[model samples]
Target chain A: MSSRRAPRVHGLMTRGYADDLRLFGSGKAKLGLLALVLAYLMLPFFLTSDFWLSVLDYAGIAAIGALGLNLLTGYTGQVSLGHAFFIGLGAYAAAQLGGPDALNLPLPLWLLGAAVFGALVGALIGPFALRLRGNYLAIVTLGLIFLGEHLFRNLKDVTGGNSGTNVDTTATLGGLDFKDLALLGENFSFNQGYFWLIWGLVGLVALLVKNLVRTRPGRALQAVRDRDVAAEVVGVQLGRYKVGAFAVSSGLAALAGALLGSYQQFVSPDEFSLFLSIQYIAIIIVGGVGTVFGSIVGALVLGGLPGLIDKYSASIPGVSTGSGDSGFISVFSLNQAIFGLLIVLFLVFEPRGLAAVWLRVKAYFKAWPFSY
Target chain B: MSEFLQLCFNGTALGARYALVALGFVIIYRATGVINFAQGGLLALGAYLAYALNDTAALPFALAVIGAVIASGLIGAATERVVLRRMVGQPVFAVVMVTIGMLFILEQTITSIWGFEALNLGDPWGVQIVRAGDVVLAQRDLWTVGIAGAVLAAFFAFFRFSKLGVAMRATAFDQEAALAQGISARRVFAVSWGISGALACLAGVTLAAGPAALSPGIGAVALIAFPAMIVGGLDSPVGAVLGGLIIGITQALTTGYQEDLFGWAGANFAAVMPYVVMVLILLVRPYGLFGTREVRRI
Candidate 1:
């Protein structure tokens, strides 16, 4: 009887490195993932409200961008205020490639093309990261936003100038048109279709990022974040990972921007302002700095806030909806103020953010039998 | 030749305002190692406050400017005390973001009080110009140069001789060593912010001196001043002024010659001119003309 090893606990025990690196090791985890998939497929059908669907769709797009930012900032430790630039780049790319007056490519082609374009531009900017560090890098990226805005306004033919351009692009994915989805003989509305498409892509990005972070390259990124010099001494190629991370992060941002342009059907240069970049930075900060799931979680929480505020501003006290109102400030000012307050409050009180809170809860439950 | 001189004169005036704002940035950075994004917010707030005091309260113009400067200094010190104190040991990224957050709040607070409409600053100088040969200067612009120069000279003297200023320099040199020497790092930080705020107000007053000059958009000049600060070197007061003048002249020249020389660059090219010059300079020097190279960065 002593020769036989005691029965290992299902989750608390791990046999090898393979088990340690498994995405969903326990049966419970696999079941939870299956349930989440079911919910994803079932969600749009029941929650058919246009407003809610739009909110969720936007959240999904923000999730994609935040995921990319997390990979760069949270994992690789590069702060960029130029996210809006890449996003703007993606939107214009979509407009040029997918618009009827232009190349009018299929959905996949245009979207992928936008991502590729963003990656290329991002790679070009990556060298700046090599040259600059910390505050210099941040200010340089801030310059990128202004320079990008200048370009967006001046490049009339491509960007349609400051007046902006429409993006009445198609959303068909080999017979599965996200514009009007029809699955198993049931037709879904435009918002519903888009909700599924965006969220599905979000899931894919989350999975892809998860996989990346779990691998050797992912460890390399975290090492770079922790101590770049130490990482260099330990045989990590600083240039390759740093540049590669930038390319991937910006590529993801462009992907989000393409969706935003297509969904809104209008791509304005002003839409990708420093404020937009700040919003993404705020989202990542609010959600969790470096965690993969935290980006999605943060997006879910903050992505719909502006829309919600805009929708409910009439009822909210101290927010003047129109001209000559009693309230001192407009809804726009209130939203920005709130964002500012949140960033300050979260950083001051909870620097690790909501992800850390969620982890604490999970950890508590996992070790329920013994507090230690 | 007159046109060139005119451009140089105008650029000098513009750069003077930039110098004041960039000096604020340099002081805070030297003391706290923080690039306060909220400096622009403070600039706007100071201008609005001046508007309120001069127009609403009907105070004397000089008194109004003084009051605005003093109030902004208090607010700046209070900000360091209340918010930034919590971020003492945090990384630079977190600290910078906190300032950005403060910026949005401050800007909104200004708008909420003053609204977005461009208002009269109630300045004594109203469309008054002084002609020097073929080059004409607005009284406000001339005063702007004078006030900026005076303030900068005062600051240089203060930093060189004043006990507090020497303490600030010591703290900037080594906070721990300064603390060991019994210098109050906290007092130095608070004083730096207060001094920065006061400078921002003076810049704001100059910027908002002309007729219908006071507006929320006046604050954005601080963002442009970023290039000036970078070009000067983040820590060097002298660099900030020189960088400001260089950028200011370059911008003025670009705008003056837009149609003839920079037609291909599109309209409003002068707005981003400073950034372009900064990039070029950084490519060669990395740390402005006079900034010390970082050794063993923490």
Candidate 2:
């Protein structure tokens, strides 16, 4: 009976397209997901440190932005160094719609408003993508960052100019303020409360993106990314899909920006630079291009790294935590150097990124003994 | 009229620097099909290297500039050999990001060594000006324009006559065919990067020699050079020079007239004028003024 059962369990062989598209293809995947969910629920309670909680929270925010970028550059094959522009747009939108001396809307409304605004702007820019290809498009998008910076700095009434504006957007939703959560008669710190809120959204966004990428539209996107001309020959409406991808990607970026602004409680023009856009690009690259899960993995690793470094700077040799310290390199320079090194090393050694490594490990175990 | 003339002179000088930088971009882009984002880092490195040679090593100004250029060229060649040579046949995005990665690393390394403080390059050209019919031009600006012109002429002649230059052009035109013709693609690539580095060094020294002190922000001039290269056409050397001049003049005029005529655009509108002009020009000519239109095959 045991020998017969061993033959019967041929291990999640796909018989059809639906099986291929299954989110959890095997019992192991389901178990892995369960473990993830359990960890998400229990980790905050176990750790209970504000510093680590905030780091995780920031990582979740980065994951959201990286997911958006992956959709654009990774999946759609559109290289944009202008993500920071849309992010800035969203931050200022939040400032106007939800901050003090403004309309003061609730959390959901402002976030949605920012997304809508970003989508509109993205739509306006999408026509250029239709005309230009490759390097031209990249450079034009780069111009958008400078143009956006100019607008942000000049629009003092809305953005509060160079000094930046305070974001008083409350995280309250249906009488449950994430800034000070009262859950099951237990009061949690702001960081603890925010971790749940941010990570929950991360899960939601991840699920949404995963579902999108698995469906017909997702196939169309990948098709366009691989070869736009061939995709067009196959009767894919090039303009609609291209514009739609832009709108969706920028909308997600804007949503992430809204979260970032509210979380930091300050929205500044300086915060949105070309470097920030590069950081998002790096995350998607390091995580795994064309894989939704890679975005979160990248964010968790790269996003949490800076904070960890800052916290342990005192212990690290040859790194000055403060100005006028006895060190050759400042913390800022060290961080920049690390980011650069990570990008170079990852592209050179493992172009497929962390997700590929994870898949390899899984494949090794799955093919145990057979070695095929 | 004199003020306008002065602005034009200043713009021309600025454009000369931009042309040098844009020309460097064209060389690398033409040969390897990779946009070297690290050019800015190279520019900074060159300027700083010159500073070290001149001030620290007590070399003559010309000797320091030559030494810096040679050192930067070697570094550029080594980068191509070590990192980018392996990236041959990779996707354009990946290659571009690699350069960007190099850029960040180079920038931070410079900052770590040099710190953030601005320092004079100690060039012979101080703040002295030469007046010509009510228009005052800095002596350094004149030298910049003169040197840029000479270099551009020499490069064009090299491309027209030299064997190695012809080989590089052949590689740029058709890599497989060039290889079939027995041209060493690796040597061409390394040589292209070296030339680009030397050009960047020249641009850096010229820009930092005048009133503008050498600082970390000197690298950012390469960002402005992007508009010049794009406006002229990415693959065209002559186009890059023309684009640089157009962008430089427009920027100068914008700075001179913004307060009086276009205050609504905000302060320092001149800073972004290159981008504005680039976008407008790109709208009309998607391939740029001199860029070859890409031919697609099914």
TM-score of 2: 0.98
Q: Which candidate is the best by DockQ?
A: 2
True contacts kept of each: 0.70, 0.68
Model 2's alpha-carbon lDDT is 0.90
What DockQ class does candidate 2 belong to?
medium
Q: Please write out the lDDT profile of model 2 over residues B1-298, one tens digit for every residue.
A: 9999999999999999999999999999999999998999999999999999999999999999999999999988999999999899888788888998899999999998999899899999989899999999899999999999999999999998999999999999999999999999999999999999999999999999968889988998998999999999999999999999998989999999999998999888898899999999999998789999888655
Proportion of true inter-chain contacts also present in candidate 2 = 0.68
Native-referenced TM-scores of chain A, all candidate models: 0.96, 0.95
Backbone clash pairs for candidate 1 read B232-B239
Q: Individual DockQ of the candidates?
A: 0.72, 0.76
